[model samples]
Target: MIKNLLFDFGDVFINLDKKAPEQALAKMGIRTIDEEMTTWHNTYEKGLITSDQLIENYLKKFPQLTALSFQQAWNSIILDFPQERLDWIIELAKSKKYRLLLLSNTNDLHIEQVIKNMGAVRYSQFQNCFERFYLSQQINLRKPDLEIYDFVLRKDDLLANETLFIDDTILNTAAASSMGIHTWHLEPGFEDVTQLFEVKKALF
Candidate 1:
């Protein structure tokens, strides 16, 4: 039986424009996201580098852009958190059917944007619904890495077989599945998190 529900924040619950950041960067004259940029982004998400350091790196590389502009472009990926999804999660939490945990691969700047867009009260309500809310930057762990999945399972003393992890990225879900955890790689347009029970009925 699925006793724990592990959910990803982006695309699963909150809406995200996956291509927005790159598009925004393109507008700033940085047309393609190179390997160096990807490394820096991953490092930031893993909390290995501070936000200041990240901005510094970018500013150093593309001297044409200001810190404010770079930050704005970076944060453009975050969109909005829908009300119905929040309501569903809140109701699900109240039901006490499973231990709800939120695990997201996100950095500080993006999280700040999420809070600003969601408003403090709504964000708090959504957070309150989860037993443990884990952010990649805060936890020093990012998805698609086996260590992260191991860390979560060990920290919570959760059994892989009894926990269901839902994420938008196939790489993340595949990593979790490799460790014996059940996962649903939810498609953004076709699949919504509110349909969890119906979609994965057999697991429930």
Candidate 2:
């Protein structure tokens, strides 16, 4: 039986438009999200570079840029947060049948927007759904990298077989599976996972 559930926040729970970056940047004369975006994001997610460095890199490339512009541009992917999902997650958390943990490859900017978009109360309610929450920027480790999974499993003394990891990215799912953690891929537009997994009884 699965005694723990590891959730990914971005696309799995809240909606994320993967195509938004290209669309948003296109308006700023950035024809494509190429090396600059890829390199900056990888470095930032790996905790190898600071948020400021990322802003400066882009700002230098486009002289007419402000912090707010960067914030909006970078956070274009995070769409709406559905109330039903929040309610479902909270119900599952209250069930106490399984340990709930959140693991996401995220940066400070993304989190700041979430707090702003969902108000303090809603954001707190969302966070309360997890026994523990892990963000790549804060933790200095990211998914698809073995160390992050190891960090969660070893630090929590959690057995891989007892945990179910959920992520929208196949790479992350594969990484967890390599270590024996069962995984579910939340496909784009697949809003509800109630029928997908045997969730906590409380969510019923």
Candidate 3:
């Protein structure tokens, strides 16, 4: 039986414009993110680098864009959380049937933007629903990485087969599944997290 539930924050709980960063950068005349940029971004998500380092790196490559402008472009991917999803999770927490955990690959700039978008009151309510909240930037670990999944499992003393991991990204879910965790790879737009009971009836 699934006694523990691990959820991805982006798309699964809150809405995210996956392509917003590229679009935001494009508007600034940078059409593409090269391999080096991709490495930098991943490093930032892993908390291996600081925000100032990222800004300095970007400034070196694109002298035209200021630190503030780059930060705005970087944080463009975050969007609002729907109230219905919040209600569902809050209800689920009230039941106290399963251990709830939130895991996300997020950075400082984006997290700040999330607080601003979600409002302090609502964000606190959403956070209180979870037993543990792990953000990549804060944890120094990221999804799609077996080590990170192992850390969560070990830290929580959770059995892999008894845990269900839900994420919008196929890569993340696949990694979790390989570790013997049950998973739901939620499809954006077509599938909503609020319909968890209806969608994964067998699990319940």
lDDT of each: 0.95, 0.83, 0.94
Which candidate, 1 or 3, has the higher TM-score? 1
TM-score of 3: 0.98
Ranking by lDDT: 1, 3, 2
Q: Which candidate is the best by lDDT?
A: 1
lDDT of 1 by residue, 109-204 (tens): 998999999999999999999999999998898999999999999999999999999999999999999999999999999999999999999998
Q: Write the per-residue lDDT of candidate 3 for residues 150-180, one digit (tens) a residue.
A: 9999999999999999999999999999999
How many clashing pairs per prediction, in order? 0, 0, 0
**Global CA lDDT computed for model 2:** 0.83
Candidate 2 residue pairs in backbone clash: none
Model 3: worst 10 consecutive residues (lDDT sum): 195-204
